[model samples]
Target: MNIVGQLAPLAFGLAVIGSGIGVGIIVGKTIESVARQPELQGRLSSLMFLGIALTEALCFIAIAVAFIPFPKP
Candidate 1:
């Protein structure tokens, strides 16, 4: 009901949006790389998954942080 409460959700929304963009970029680049060199598809795919996992982890961390109770000023 206060400013902090309102901003917490907004921050989480931004985090989610960022994660989505990060994932899109990762996949798009990976596809481009694989298209250029079909033989490197295996390596490129693994790296892409790693990047996506790390990117999604940010969203999870944001969700956890948003639920933490902040001390009232």
Candidate 2:
């Protein structure tokens, strides 16, 4: 297989892995914050979702880049 073809999948996997780590950290903190302030559950939940979406978006961008053909030299 072509090197560039191999790289696309590698890049996609790394993007997903990176996003997962980021989402986990954000959600973990949100959970901790909610535990400390039960009444702020609603607000914390929204913030958590926002973070997840942003992180996921990064992965989507990576996927797009991976699929893109390298520019002609």
Every candidate's lDDT: 0.93, 0.92
TM-score against truth, every candidate: 0.90, 0.90
After superposition, candidate 2 runs with Cα above 4 Å error: none
lDDT of 1 at 33: 99
Score residue 66 of candidate 1 by CA lDDT: 81
Candidate 2, number of clashes: 0
Estimate, for each residue in 1-73, the C-alpha lDDT of model 2 and write its tens digit.
Answer: 4668889879988999999999999999999999999999999999999999999999999999888787655
